[model samples]
Target: MNTRKRQLAMTALGVATLAITAVGTQGAPPAPPWFTWTTVVNNGDFMPTDSCVPTAPSTPPCRTFNSYNQPSVNANQVVVIRARSRGGQGGQAVHGVYTRDMAAAGPVVRILDRSTLVPQPNNLDSTFIEPPSFPRIDIGMDTVATRGNHQPVWRYFLDDVTETRAGTTGVYTNPFGDLIAGASKLGAVPDFSFFEVPEAPGTPFDVFPGAPAVTDGATIAFKGNYPVNGVGKTGVYYRDLENAPIPLSADNLEPAGGSNPVVLIANSLDTFIPGTRTIFGSTAPPSAANRQMVFAGFDNEDKPTLGGIYLAPLNGTTQPPLRTLVAIGGQVPGENSKARFNRLGEGVSFDGRFVAFWGAWGTEKKTLVLQCRTEGNADRVAFCNQQHPNGFITTVPVNQGIFVHDLGTRQTQVVAKTPADYDDFVYWNFSGRTPGTGEGDDDGELARWRSASFVAVSGLVDGTLTDATFHAAFKARTGILMSGTYAEPVDGIYLREGPGKASLLTLVETDMDGSLIDPEAVDDLGAALPVTEMGIERDGFRGNSLVINASMGTEETGWAGIYLTEVPE
Candidate 1:
């Protein structure tokens, strides 16, 4: 997933319901080929606020459903950021919120309806910097919270809300009742103070960098930078939505018990903020009886040490138990600089036992594959070393490798890549020379393996054989669903059932008739461009769905729209 998509998935926070047209499950056996494509929301059917400039004269001034939207989902519903007002010629677009029920039958519902007012010049000083009078809503992760009576709660960040440092003359009074040091109104709500800038002598940090994760129990845990009053301290703070925001890795909770917080470990540095977290438990309607959180902290603050992933319990305690499942500096030579956890995001087993993540070992002719225990608070770095003293299962020319750490055994296993397969696979555009080539620079690397043993690796790579032959062989051996122009059609999303051939997952061109909106209601209703980007939900109704952002001919042709799809169970 890209940075923007990752942020959308992580930042989503809210609870709203919409009408859904119930599509019956496949009557035949549940398997591949049983997949069905249903349109959640297309243009025309999706209504923007009245403020948007309308394309037709008889129609009210409005904008079409924006293509730049990001979507989030739970077992029962899907939410997205829909733009209502289109900026005419050189104007700015206005946005609104929308949702759809996965179980009911109806059109997409607009919870925060858009305004009908004409586009106005932006007042940068106002809560909303743009023309829309509504707050700019950025949706993040969504969860089915039982605490709120099984309601669907979605996480979101609102821009344009007032955070006045000084009271106004009836124009604005602090809605939060209390005030923080900074006067910025860009943060989450129902708990807005969590992102405010504190006064001097306190850690005046910005909003949570990474997004928050919500559990089925209505508990939310996020990466936040908080400053304590009278204490000059700063670090990523972990807060649960059930109570007041408290620092799980605060300065007081560190080994020194002051400004130097432990950062979710026995003795870790304070530079480990801006980390990613994953909350795991039983299937849908996750049970809190055995829920847990796994995360990786980075030394972004430039501490003299390398960062590692940590695990903690969410048993409703003020300070739940925490430990260093994996730390820096091990048996591997120069591991401090060579090996690093897949920091893109966190991934945990359904039962919250084993956690899987990729470890990049740099350009060296080796892939560092390691794991640690998540079942206990014991230090497992020694155990991990004992299992693989060389710091990896095998050495291969490939830099990207997957590893799974068994929490129970406290042992790590290399799931992908081995010395035996060295030079067996080459990245896309491989000239059969140079170690790392062809889109090798990892930025938004997304490697997700579903409930099955197979995984979909982004980017194209060939082996000693043709691209098709290489992909087939690789999938047979590693269960990796990989494809490219040499093996499949170009400019489209495709899914493969390992051990066989790849199948197209999406279309590069389609008419507007498939859209949920009326035929005459929209102009240039056809969708163009191919699947430019895609992200498979790692958990939470992810087994059957995936998200993609697509575009038409160009920006003038209405450039983007985010869509969600479901496959056979």
Candidate 2:
């Protein structure tokens, strides 16, 4: 075999291998073996007016479905998400407005038609966007109830849709509701529909429905936690769609209020914010100490005596709650040189200890990985920490702006960065190394397990728009789906396929690179499923690269919605 002939033969073989297709479950189109794509939601056609994106008469039957897209046609999983900026001083987003998204796998996409109360975008000065969910979904929306213009305000919608005290309900994809925070809830309508969480549950601060997955086919899984103070507020939680109004007044869930009485904790409007969260130690509950690090507060206003790492043991069935933990960002005179801190976007991990956050304190322009030692009242100081661990083949900020931090590493890698002036996002994955248990100790028995890996990360840049951007300017995202296959953000959808793996997947787009309408469309189409924005877990729908596009005047009608495609391999 001559050199040229050998090369030609190998090339042909590769092409042939790429062409092989496998039929997904229940008669889906034949796509590449072990690889499938699907559409979960497509509300792009809905009119932009009305509190809920008007469910205009459409050919695709809008069936009522679960927002937390669960179930899998095969090994792969997915979710479609949409959102519009709040158009206020800061570009804050209100999510979880739509009902269920269209789901596609292989060549088959299923869209559920239901009377969903989608939120109406202000359309004033915001960008409506729809992205795909990989390991889990992160969606929430808000609604405002005002008596005319000058009247008193009533209810407020986070996603700008659900009618408070009226027809407002959260749907989840997980089958059995959880015992922790009400991250999972049944829909107001559609008897059995479940709503996926829109915000990321920051562990060590709070725990909600997270790590969404389908086990044993019909069994859906999400994270659950126990609240500390009666007002300590339980973390991002899940309400078993099957077990609404769960009778969980135990120390495990809500820590009974009175002498072992359950505390009635309320979740905040920002419950579903995306970022990294940690799981409490295996030994929690029963003990009154801080059982977990489900939630943490961000105090950038002023530097305090104790860094903003809140820690207050729960009083006996009698005492009130203790002080909260905090870490100030910026210089604090004679304080430690760590300076002030800034929390990257919000999200979480399974165990609820170690966290990945970004900060811009004096002098240091970098990221940090803060860790907690114990769970519950025993939540001592951070024991293990890994700051801004990157998994790129080249020397780059592996995973910048840490969003969702997990204990076990996966096959995710950071690919590329976006150019200036472009809309860019970042993506993270659990790029499993050949030897999963190395890096720290040789015994492979170091403190439970080795929670370290060379993460595969990527970012996209635009061809136009050249502006200097600090590393903090970009953000990260992730989503979940039925099959459990997580889709971490990559450079573009066109990137070649690797072996399927990951618990969560999300796309992180960078901000402002000259022009990036085409790639954004491509990435959008590739990352999203037919159904979007309503699942407990999300994946792959992430990356940090961005392409700037021509501004759409406020004349727009519809709010931003995530869209995607599943091309034939």
Candidate 3:
């Protein structure tokens, strides 16, 4: 057995012993109060047949969904997600964006899918390749916004023959109406007549990276990239859709001004990095609520120590300057005066009053050695050996922690940290397939990494800063190696209520009963499958509802799905 499996086996033995002793002493403790689990959607659930389109002879019928991305929940208990269906459609994977009203136990409704027509200018209909991940919904409303990759529609007359351009991606939204039937084109690229980069007049957007965020007021905030003077530029921008024309009818084919003007929030070339002398080199996708936006900015893209999170007000007549919420060099709360943040993650959770984020500090480091699990694939074995001649790869670890910053009070609260509440806050993995004998693909996951913690906050939204009732939900990986044996790390979602509270209530964790994921799922041995993996993006928690994606099973058989539960403050 590999090191990980061996460690799991040893940990299982210890846990079994503890369970027997606990039953004899305390006759089993009360179940966690936060686990009122409700299944949102699961793998193998049949998708809407209407979404399937037989474009090619090899195209098969769209059947059950096989995978899901992180989900987002709104205050109404509505969840918006992006999922993929595999196998049945042999030609290509069928991808789509969907929403469900968890409060009413309603059926899943499709917003858009690969077969759906891409609403474009002048009725130049196109089809989407896939709906990008991280589809978002407004907190107070159901306005959904996402980035869509579609067929290029920009056409030119070349030698009298119509030729289409290459650019084919842009931000889109479903305005406040029937999300499915009312979906319309919000903004798209290569069509300068309809969309242009703000401030860089006449320059059309090259691409919109990341999922767009929608406000309750129908304002869309996104990070857009374009070229200016033959050089590339990027910024975070927003467009007010309340007055913008909707392409729901032929008469509203285009905006009155030819193009809807997107207001610039910040850009890499001009926006000053708060608390630093250098300007912002880049900005992450923003989170907006209650007419305010929160985003992380970096003065040095290559250095995490030069980054911080800022809040920009969207209600002001003039673009208000950004207010520094936290910085990399800022003193960490409850730590020594000398302790300062050395790293800040790009993902943040903002609910108007509170901004929950993760950062790293301290000088202590942990090294993780990774060896490829070849699984008897000769190509993988050769690739791994060639990549790591020493037989292993190692990661340089830093101290990590999660924090909640109150915009009203201007106070920061440390929720959890490494070596105290968990072992590590981030993990690395190899992604993509091994290359063939020839040249290799530039897949992002060769040594890709992701943080284990994605935090969200819920508190009184009474427009007051003094409200002390703040609840934070974050993902954590705990357990550490002691002596020569490794204690299997427990990946879990936890809730920390109130500011500076050290105690955290377990919301969900690995090795828990599979009933929490799906009561009917079991392994081949006829026993409940234990929870295996959990996933939550930055926006997974909103209001009092926390939604997450989980995988359950034993080594042989398993299932994955999305689950929702209440986190009472």
Best by TM-score: 3
Which runs of model 1 end up more than 4 angstroms from their true locations?
1-35, 43-45, 48-59, 80-85, 89-91, 110-205, 226-234, 238-291, 300-305, 316-319, 323-356, 365-398, 402-529, 535-543, 558-560
418-468, model 3: which lDDT tens digit per residue? 666676666443433465431111111233222334777777422234686
Number of the predicted model whose lDDT against the real structure is largest: 3
Worst ten in a row by lDDT for model 1: 166-175
Give model 2's clash tally.
226
- Provide TM-scores for the models: 0.46, 0.31, 0.81
lDDT of 2 by residue, 1-569 (tens): 01111011112113332221111224533232221222333323332222332343333322221122222111122332322223231222222223232332322121211212222111122221211222232211111000000111113333558654221211123223221122222222121122322232211222222233222222222333333444333222212222233232231222111111122111232222122232212111110111323233332212222223322222222112323222334232223565333432223221122222332223322232222322211111112223212211211122232222222231112222222111123333222111332211111123221222112211111111122111111232322211322233112122211112111112212121101212222233343111111111122222222111111111122112233323212
Distance from true position, residue 212, model 2, in Å?
Answer: 11
User: CA lDDT, every prediction?
Assistant: 0.30, 0.23, 0.66
Looking at model 2, residue 293 earns an lDDT score of 30
Quick one: RMSD of model 2?
A: 19.9
